[model samples]
Target: MSRPRRLLTLGHSYVVGTNRRLARAMAQAGAGEWEVTAAAPAAFPGDLGPITLQPEAGERVVPVSVHGAGRIHTMRYGPELRDLLRQEWDVVHCWEEPFIVSGAQVAAWTPRGAKLVFATFQNLPKRYPPPFSWMERYTMRRADGWIAFGRLVAEVLGARGIYDRRPHRVIAPGVDTTLFRPDRDAGARIRSSLGWMDDAAPVVGYLGRFVPEKGIETLMAALDGCAQPWRALFVGGGPLEAEVRAWAGRYGDRVRIVTGVAHDAVPDFVNAMDLLCAPSRTTRRWHEQLGRMLTEAMACGVPVAGSDSGEIPFVIGDAGLVIPENDVAAWTREIDALLASPQRRADLASRGRARAEAEFALDVVARQHLDFFDNLLMETR
Candidate 1:
């Protein structure tokens, strides 16, 4: 007998790639019994044909297309996208971007009796321009159901009246435990690559967009306020690079900024940190919906300190400290306290590693997602 018809996922680059990792975990867990295909804007023409994941993320990309006409502006897929959606799949899911409206558009236009889901990752207010948001909401209402990455996201949608009184579920983003887990061998290599000498100062790291919403400026200010011999390292590039560099200059040779690093190298980057901090502020267009980097750091057995923005407090739990957003003084105190107590930092690291392995382990997370999708298809049928 042939394998079970399974999932078709629609998403932008990040999500599509993450879902592929889950699919791999599913395959390894004997959950591979189903057929899975992704409908994201690929670099080329056809389904990048079924291929195993390479250490290089580029090797796993599948092909897809997008038509020009749409209610939302997708990142421009080719015309082949529609036919891919019409294929026999038990469930269809749209990822973070409206790329396929997380696949609902393709599903709605497909023949009847399809289980379509829209995965909404925004915990903050939608930033899309006026009239477009109305149409976007309408398209989302058209889906069979919706998916929220976490409780905070679900609540935000619920509070903002985004959920159309339709069925929805909250399943958080996952990390690849196998690749990101604690590796003693990789730790020294990571430190060496980053140029941290025995006499080098403690490293503080941040990962994500460097835009105003990310509150990187606040981080820079807080770091400058601290008297400790510290080096701030960043793994992402954003519009505020020049400003950030200028601000760091006041602290002398205490800041190092790398434009950006690939996702596969995130573990090494976090492993190189003495502490990872996300100083995201809750603002009109801002909220750190899910602390993806913090989780990645935890997976690397590193302690993280972040603010109580959006799901961050929930994300951090008891694993690390949470200070008020935009409070440079509190930020200083938190860092100083952590630096003063190595035992506390060690405890946080242990707790963080436990949390990473228990809650967000790739295999467990993938299974939860697979079961959720499987149940949704069964119920809708």
Candidate 2:
């Protein structure tokens, strides 16, 4: 039998076990065909607090010290990474932005025989300043291929000509179906805890950062204008927390704003919702890359409604409703329509779950990545 290919993946996000699902899934999916090792930081600063590396069973994970721990642009791996890179690898996959210092370091140290691929979520084209631009140039020059987190990301990077003549694929992020699938009992428990046991109103949820660009105001307005009875749950913390709390105060028990919910407990909150809304508004420099919440909700068999901003429409596709980013009236109308018809909600939930399984499930995404890597290795040989 031929020897299995060695695959090494490195990323800061892997410090969290949930974010390491891709690597774990790949290892499982490619068993007997490939050997996968994931490298993550021992500790990194998180939004809520310091996050220690949480490795999962059945996956080969190595915890390495990271300099400038929380800072993506400036962070660099410790000497252990240098030794790891010196080892033989068939593929080196970097889950960092190509314009960052860590990315350049990876590109520079990757063995010449190995195919190095970088994954990115930057959906906008911008002329990055000084060292970042230099770093991007060096990394791209060395990269054997690249992966875009969304269609818009591929389009933007392709148009920039940064990846001209290089191979790239549009691979969306994955969701753990086992962790996110429908759970009515869990939903009931959450509702009961929220003092909403008697309320039959459909729950409208927003599950990302509570920032202005997320269109929190638009969601609040839509809730106000919703002709049908509804409950609201905003899960997450950000600069707009105080404002969200103040707004939720008006509805008393009808609305709940939950901050600091850990990633592992997010499924409970998602299950509590009848529908999830991602009303992201685009700004000059930033727009939604891919609303991972959409996939998670879909995986949970929850109907989703999102704005047409950036990749939301692409991510949602035909599985759920898509409203204009800033159209409060349209948002109100569509949300009302969904809430009014359980049939529509059920249909969307069914379609969304199917979509999640077909496209965004962990194993499905892992297979896609392995295929890409196989093709790259074949072409190079």
Candidate 3:
């Protein structure tokens, strides 16, 4: 048999082990057909703190030093990456935005024979300024293909005519089903730990950054208007933490706000919820890219309710409830309707879990990536 195709994937977010699940999944899914290696920053500043490279099983990961570590647009990998890029490979996949300086560097260094693919989650259509725009143009000129993390991204970039004739695919990010599956015991444990031993009221949860753009105020108002007896659990930390805490104070023990949660522990909190809400509000510059938390909740057998902002509706896709982004009354009515009937919640939970397994599971997503790569390689050959 001919030698297996070698693949190299580079991303800054790979510093976190959980985020490297895609690389691991690719390696496993492509076994005997492809050889995979991932290059990540040795250490990078994260929202909670500095994140050190954490390698997972069944995959090869290289930790290279980086300059301007946390600055997405400005950071550049050290000489080690340049040296690695010189090596022969069938494909070089970049997880950075094409408009960033590092992306330009990768595009410039990739071997001539290799297929280069860049992944992006940018859904907005604003024209970037100066060097960023220059970098995007340069990178796209050399790219063999690109991957958009959501449909919105593909539509936005496609409209700009940047990918006119190039092959591109819309692939959503994957979630580890094994790590995020339903566990009644785990849910009970989390609720008990949070002093919610009674379990009499259904717990409504939010699992993302506590920012204004996340529609925290809208969520608060909707919950206040909820006629049904419900408990709220907010898992994540951001600039709006103080505001969230102050808002939760009025509810006494009906609300809980958790901060600095590790990625692995996320499933426990998710399982604790009867329903998950993603109330992201679109702003001038930003919109919900994928709403990863939606998949996680669905994977945990928890129903979800999301706003119509950006990709939320697409991600939910009839599996769960979709409310208006900033419509307090709509959110209140929908949330109340779900909370009023366990039968409805159970139906949504079942559908959501099925959707997660079929569309968002790691193995499913990994196979999609491999198929796309296989097609790209075949076209070139």
Q: Name the lDDT of candidate 3.
A: 0.92
Question: Local distance difference test, per candidate?
Answer: 0.70, 0.93, 0.92
Model 2 clash count equals: 0
Point out the higher-scoring one by lDDT: 1 or 2: 2
Query: lDDT by residue for model 2 over 113-232, one digit each (tens)?
Result: 999999999998888898999999999999999999999999989986669668999999999999999998898999998889735799999999989999999999999998899999
Q: In model 2, where do residues sit more than 4 Å from their true spots?
A: none
For each candidate, give its TM-score against the true structure: 0.85, 0.98, 0.98
**Model 2, C-alpha of 207: deviation from truth (Å):** 0.5
Clashes of each: 8, 0, 0
Q: For model 3, how does the per-residue alpha-carbon lDDT over 1-381 read when each residue is reduced to its tens digit?
A: 999899999988898888889999999998998899999999999877788887766679998888997678899988989999999999999999889989999999998899999999989987999889999998999998999899998998888767756789999999999999999899999999999975579999999998998998899999999999999999998999998999999999899999988889999999999999999999998999989999999999999999999999999998999998999999999999999999999999999999999999999999998888889999966
Off by over 4 Å in 3: none
Q: Pick the candidate with the highest lDDT.
A: 2
Q: Model 1, 227-341: lDDT tens per residue?
A: 7677777878778988987876766656667764766777777777778999988887667889898888888887899998888888888998888999999998888777667
List clashing residue pairs in candidate 2: none
| Ranked candidates, highest lDDT first | 2, 3, 1
